[model samples]
Target: MADKEVQNSKKPPSKSVSVVNKTSSVSEDTPKTVPNKGPQVLCLRILNSLNENMKSQKERFEKLESAQYYD
Candidate 1:
């Protein structure tokens, strides 16, 4: 039983290594291409909105700081 467990443990790593090698070779042979633009468009929209929000917050903070300095 102990020998069997040791043999079984050793077998899995070799099998996994071969699978990883095959996948890496396949990806290298395939040309990279964008499958869809939907996710990309959504991400850009979210980023733009966040950027606008940050600009507004910065302006508001500056106004508050200037008012406090005047007082």
Candidate 2:
């Protein structure tokens, strides 16, 4: 019984990238929506600054992964 259970567990499960048997034209005509570009640029700059800031902080705090994490 244990061996049967192990064999069943070891069996690979199936996964589908696509779903089947939909009634409607569930396919999208086009993708939806847009995001603000300004925030993205700001985020990039902030992330870069964070990396720089963390480099020094690690020496002060052994727990810190990076000095940039504080900023």
lDDT score of residue 63 within candidate 2: 54
TM-score of each: 0.49, 0.32
lDDT, model 1: 0.65
Each candidate's clash count: 0, 4
Clashing residue pairs in candidate 1, if any? none
The per-model lDDT (C-alpha) reads 0.65, 0.59
lDDT of 2 by residue, 1-71 (tens): 89999998997878768768754321233223336578866675565566556655756576554646766
Candidate 1 positional error at 65, Å: 0.4
Where is the poorest 10-residue window by lDDT in model 1? 23-32
Top candidate by lDDT: 1
18: Cα error in model 2, Å: 19
- Quantify how close model 1 is to the true structure by its C-alpha RMSD in Å: 12.2
Q: Write one digit per residue (lDDT tens) for candidate 1, span 3-66.
A: 9988878765443343444421222333334456889766655666666677789999999999
CA lDDT, candidate 2, residue 22:
58
